[model samples]
Target: MSLLLDGVTVGYRGRPVFEGLTLPPVPAGSLVSVVGPNAVGKSTLLRSIAGLLPVAGRVELTGESLTAMPRPERVRRLGYLPQTLPQAVPLVAYETVFSACRSALGSWTNADTEAAIEAVFDRLGIRHLALRRLSEMSGGQRQMVGLAQVLVRRTPLLLLDEPTSALDLRWQLNVLSAVREAADAQGAIALVASHDLNLALRFCDQLLVLTPSGRIAMGAPEVILTPELLASAYGIEARIERCSRGHPIVLADQALSTG
Candidate 1:
């Protein structure tokens, strides 16, 4: 399984966010992080791939054209979690997840659907929240439920927009670990849009950086996350250092003035 984007362009009111964007084919079981400063089109990129936006070119998955596929078929193959938190509704966590599971896997037996929901809740350590109402939960808790909704679908491709944004450090690690495990075990591809460079470096197999001037860089974190890249992409004077475990970490010293 692989995902390819060729000459993909997305915009609002004809103002292009991504103009003719193309990327190398992403193989299955790879976890890629899309990182860049605000308004650099990270969300737009994921949205286009998720078939939620209009595009100019081709988006293919394993030789099938996602852009041309029927909406139901495309949704079955791709799961997307937006950056916004799940709505605070009257539904409890378990009920919400069950609804999501039923919607995606309508043919599944009730027992199987319940089993999947339980498994995802256990994996994400959100089982305790199962009985809690969404309206009573915090933003972070709601975010975790949002993720569980996607995870239970078992789609071949996951597009998560800042899945860890509202999560604390421990929960952030938990979320990324779960996502990584899902990708590896299912031979699926996950594209996560994140602002946290450190977590991306630690958990992602590849990094897709969007620069302020509209350049795109894709490679291993060590190869693509250089001081120069940071300056150009984020307008920061930064250093890429290695942690104790040899993971690359970005150390920002100062922000560079655009003027």
Candidate 2:
């Protein structure tokens, strides 16, 4: 249920982004959120865990090493929905997501596939756009399609890259709540990269705040979302407050001073 990385270092073509990024041992059925300055390798970390990028560390799920595993094998256990869903081909929105299981869903009839696809669309509130082409949809709509593709995957480990960026406020809460429901009902572990700090604190059981320099700042919301950490990571004076329900909120105190 947990996705553990030990001394993880990720890079591209020999150019490093993060080094010695050791995450603590998180228990099962946990939702962990990662927030950092733009281009701090947040997406790269997600890609590395999903097997889309190679790294010089161990990524394990429930004590099982995931490095170098075959893509199909990994797909059975891990579901990845990237933030940017490039139109790989001129695909109808429904068809693109249905193709995710094209390899393993061989024997299922077209009717069955359609039914399954419809269910996914219905879950994400996008069933009405079944026949539309991907290129014609707005950025937010296309992002939902990408998420639907991964949600179609009934796996234990879910990796979402900026799941709420393109989504509006309501969908942001909806999608993150969906992640929480998945963990509660199915005993799943989710690693999410998100920009909305409040949603992350509210929905995620744990927080993994990556610094602007790509260092690891891991803990619960209260421990990790302090003014000191915010100032260090985002270079802004911020105060972390607690709501009546005990959830956290970050109040930015001042703009940066160019000294």
- For TM-score, the strongest prediction is 1
lDDT (tens digit, per residue) of candidate 2 on 124-223 = 7888777888878887888888887777665788889988788798878778877887788778888899887888878888888878755568888877
lDDT of 1 at 61: 97
TM-score of each: 0.98, 0.89
- Candidate 2 regions off by >4 Å? 88-90, 104-115, 243-246
Single out the weakest 10-residue window by summed lDDT for candidate 2: 100-109
- Candidate 1: which stretches are off by over 4 Å? none
Q: lDDT score of model 2? A: 0.80
Residue by residue across 1-259, what tens digits does model 1's lDDT show?
9999999889999799988888999999999999999999999999989988888898999999998999878878999999999999989999999988888778999999989999999999999999999999999999999999999999999999999999999999999999999999999999999999999999999999998799899999988899999999999999989889887889999999979
Estimate every model's Cα lDDT from 0 to 1.
Answer: 0.94, 0.80
Residue 208 CA error for candidate 1 (Å)? 0.5
